[model samples]
Target: MDSLSEQQQQASEKPIINITGEKVALGPIRRDQVPLFYRWANDFNVLRTLHIPRPSTFEENLAFFERDVEDEKRRTVVHFTVYDRASLTPIGRVDLEEINHRDRRAEFGIEIGEPDYRGRGYGTEATRLMLDYAFTGLGLHNIGLYTWEYNLAAQAVYKKAGFREVGRRRQAKFMGGKLWDIIYMDCLSTEFVSPVLSKIMVPDEVRS
Candidate 1:
């Protein structure tokens, strides 16, 4: 089969759901999905919101997959492929990186690479699910993320997921013929009530 057909076939298969949500599910990132990641990395619409905001080659994406595998093994990062729960189609990615178990904190990052999936509630659902995993599954106390000043949509999503704007780095990024601040937002385990993990982790007696 041709590459496009093969990708579609693979995507249609039932994915191993790690964290389920209302509108989306999180699954392990597969090696076969590197081509999709490459396409998203190169898409300007997606890249513009990312911290680096640069086109990535396929080889670089391959290298990223390899590195992600190692990082996951070392427990320094946790990555997931965001899937549309209804269609089971891969739409984006969300990850908690720079994990410090001792400090109980990590940096959060997410991208809805598929433009069709943007402006929907998928990203917010995915973020909440990740937060549940981070706080309850991994016992993390704090999770932080950054976004450019121009990305109002992302800020709203993060806020809806329990993150509050803590600060900003003034004129930290130059894009689209203007400089923008790097806005910082974060949420603590105390501030968030786990939507999924708590039920699984806590006993009925303690929960009541």
Candidate 2:
């Protein structure tokens, strides 16, 4: 196949958006996109920010995707493929893991694997949309995340999206010949005002 045709074919297979913001959209993880996920998993630049310690094989990523599907069915985790809104390009992923309905809490994680998309405000917007879904759509009360101290950029984004530093695990992560603290931050439903879900949750009668 010609390069242009292949590109067109790939474009047609883009995942449909589930949740959207001004700059980014969150969509279901498509089975066909496991290869893309596998690519991200092995990107050392991306892995440095995330908790992944070693390179992952394509088969391992496939197995992980299968397990992830089962977890979604059990409602133990919620994952989304992050897309660039303007181009509808798959750029990364975001997820709420370890969800406990009784406790009303979960752990948040995000990675903008596409180097081109890094440093943009997309991550911050995506974080807000996920928080809205957790607090309002899913009725989750608290969302927490852990970031290495070296990941100052992620910490800034989390703070912008309403998370506050609850505590820290000192010198927990060793990388680049140095030890970095693991920063724990969380956002409470009471402290956040959902940008999207709030409007949906309001009574129409009240508006009238």
Candidate 3:
């Protein structure tokens, strides 16, 4: 990934049509990126934070993408591949899952699989970009997510980004040598404070 300053400079030069923030750009997942997704999905280090690691075969991973594409077509979810805007590199994936039109709510998930990219501001800004789209582009009222009890860093990011803990599933998981609860966090459109997608459409001056 490029330095934050370089990412900002690149964002200014790229077409604003890219659903991008200062550090990351969210683009539709492509066929070629499926393999990368496969690699990340099967990594124990990454899945451990979410749940017990399940190694997935390449064929299975490909099938998963196929299924997701179908779901997306049905408006079940809006998924995107995360990119480092400055370097134009695919780093991970993010999605607004289980989208309900009537309820105007969705579940959120993100994975920055590239170990080098983790802990960078990419995850943080990618989250904001997703929220902007969920609230403004999709006309959603509430967005929710769940993380493992040990994912304190992710928890902090959610709290700082306006997601409040709503509940916890007691002893729902066993990981890292202890019984851990699944923490639920949510953010309402009204509670989002970032200027990200605060407006649904880009103004004419900035759009081109």
Candidate 4:
């Protein structure tokens, strides 16, 4: 898929929000953005830790994009485009997946596709915006995520964003001929009391 194809998808489903911060924006992904998303997601380096099947065609990406933006099930998965605030171009994605309403939890994931965008704080800002949406806009009680043990950079990002390690899955991933454990981390609204209040207001803030 080319850039034109992505523009068309954006017209069809438009983003849910264009969250603005000092460095980046977390916006709703329109369906037209599917092609760009496909390329980023299918990159070998990007999909190294993701669980979805490898997509081989633009059509597969289109189908996935529609499902992600339209589905409203309590356990539904949602994704947002991480865009540069100044240029308004998608540079990566942040996702809240594996949501369980009864359990009041979901798994989070993020990636910066553009090499130049890495280490510039876009991931942190995008994640903060997404977590605000999950905990406040969606009324979720908890959000969680897992990362490969060696992904220390990601762990640091999650920690700075207020997540705490909760558990670890032993030898869960066999990649590049080696076994690796997965680290599970999570954050609760109750825990957000002081640190994140200025960054993202809780739902009660409005209600109160």
TM-score of every prediction relative to native: 0.90, 0.90, 0.86, 0.78
Candidate 3 per-residue C-alpha lDDT over 1-208 given as tens digits, one digit per residue, 9 for 90 to 100:
6699897777544423358688888888766678899899988988888766888898998998999999999999988988898886888888999999899999999898899988777888888888888888888999999998888878877776678999999998898679888999999999886456655476667655
Candidate 1 lDDT score at position 15: 77
lDDT of 2 by residue, 1-208 (tens): 9999997687567667878789999999887789999999999887888875698899999999999999999999999999999999999899999999999999999988889998888889999999999999899999999999999899999999999999999999998899999999999999998887787776657553
Best by lDDT: 1
TM-score of 2: 0.90
Name the candidate, 1 or 4, with the larger TM-score value.
1
> CA lDDT, every prediction?
0.92, 0.91, 0.84, 0.76
Please give the range of 10 consecutive residues that has the lowest summed lDDT in model 1. Answer: 199-208
- Select the stronger candidate by lDDT from 1 and 4: 1
Give the candidate number with the greatest TM-score: 1
- Name the runs in model 4 displaced over 4 angstroms: 1-17, 51-55, 73-75, 193-208
**What TM-score does candidate 1 reach?**
0.90
Against the true structure, what is every candidate's RMSD?
4.3, 4.1, 7.1, 5.3
Would you list the rank order by TM-score, best first? 1, 2, 3, 4
- lDDT score, candidate 1: 0.92
Clashing pairs in 1: none
Name the lDDT value of residue 121 in candidate 3: 76
